[model samples]
Target: MKIRPAVRRRSIRDRRDPLLTALTGLMLLYTLLPLAWLVINASKTQEGLMDSFGLWFAGDFALFENIATTFTYDGGVFTRWLLNTLLYVVLGAGGATLLAALGGYGLAKFDFPGKKAVFAIVIGAVAVPGTALAVPTFLMFSQLGLTNTPLAIIIPSLVSPFGLYLMWTFAADAVPREVLESARVDGAREFQTFFRIALPLLAPGTVTVLLFNVVATWNNYFLPLIMLKDPAWYPLTLGLDAWNKQAGTAGGEAVFHLVITGSLLTIVPLIAAFLLLQRYWQSGLTAGSVKE
Candidate 1:
């Protein structure tokens, strides 16, 4: 009799809650609808885009034509912007992740003076918005003759307060102190112990931070807009915005079709990245749930 009641409760707990399921379905639809619209509209030519329903395909499929034009148009400047974006992602996000990992590991493991002050500063930085710092950064960079150069964007992106805090918290629990003491007793130097032992254990958190920084760097616009004057240096976001604005100019070529097509192209890498790295992200989020 007791077992039957317990089994009934288990089944009840396993059953899906209708309200939660409905909300989840709605959220999924909300997320997918915009992407579907983008894909559908990308297939339309300029004429079709203005005439056809946005949610459905046009009578003529022009996706391939649009893509070819986007690549070959304006001396193939879009390709340059794509390369610039990649450079920012690789150097900026990669540097940020490395620094965050080293700093976070040190903060977690080693005892030092002013550690609490550093923690407070990190927390304060994470609370502050990037936009708030943009103007001051630009002014400082201008005085240093770094403005209108790639360094302006790259240097600022190398510091990620949130990434540092995340790694700090993760390193605190994910790496056990006993393991470090053992490594020390085994004659392992601090750097070797970190590189060989702690690094492998930090994979999930590292990947999570990398993805966050990657997305931020890839989508960055305002910073690049203020930093870069040369069109040759513009990232995809700024370049696309420039193309978008060109459509509104008097006697400018209407490249709205190209703009739409370019937008679709820009998000493909991000989607692929998230899909590829989601396992690590999920694992990172679920860390420290159960006690050993």
Candidate 2:
């Protein structure tokens, strides 16, 4: 059968969506250019870093050696910092995600007096910048003799108002009241209904919240700067900052190289985490797009 001219014209128009294709390409480049540069730079030595092209790999790849030195430098202090970061990210972010999930679920599902006021407070909390709160938190922790402790970092991290808001918004639409009522009708307790039915429904939002908190805590520096003075308790961000400062002094350029390399390494876990959890985000986004 011969194709109609009008149908052929529509096909051409669809293929010629120049604005969309250009925007997509631009966004892809924006996201990927930094990562490409980091990988290329990680392969270079100190001299190669200084003398070579900024966006390309070096002739002599020292990536393996740099990785070794990064881990073993300063009596393996970098490893300690890495472990501390892992602890903070896992405990602080993970705890915060769970709390946010529960809180948001409760706010979205339950009816109570002053619910609006409580939600208003949450929105206000989200608006307040973390940096503005750091000094006051430090003073309070100092009075309690909690300064320079991991708890100082972990405690504040556990209060993610934004995560709570996100989950609350997501749960309001994602979870059906009929399902909860059905679960209750089937003899399921409230807690069991939440855990078995609601939580599973909230998986995508939960993963998104977890990833945000994890990245935020992992990269956090200002709060730690105010709360912590001991090097032993320093997370990767603070530890890298210290290394960068030392690198500025005489005979410390080697430490500078290590710091850059360490920064690159620090991001690997974040990338891995996003790649792993992105499927959940995709599923969550698509879940309500089409209705039965």
Per-model tally of clashing residue pairs: 0, 0
Q: What stretches of model 2 exceed 4 Å from their correct place?
A: 1-16, 285-292
Error (Å) of candidate 2 at residue 212 is 1.0
RMSD of 1: 2.5
CA lDDT, every prediction?
A: 0.94, 0.91
Q: Write the per-residue lDDT of candidate 2 for residues 50-131, one digit (tens) a residue.
A: 8889898879999889999999998999999999999998899999999999999999999999999999999999999999
RMSD of each: 2.5, 3.4
TM-score of 2: 0.89
Clashing pairs in 2: none
Q: Point out where model 1 deviates above 4 Å.
A: 1-16, 290-292
**Per-residue error at 33 for model 1, in Å?**
1.1
Query: TM-score for every candidate vs. truth?
Result: 0.93, 0.89
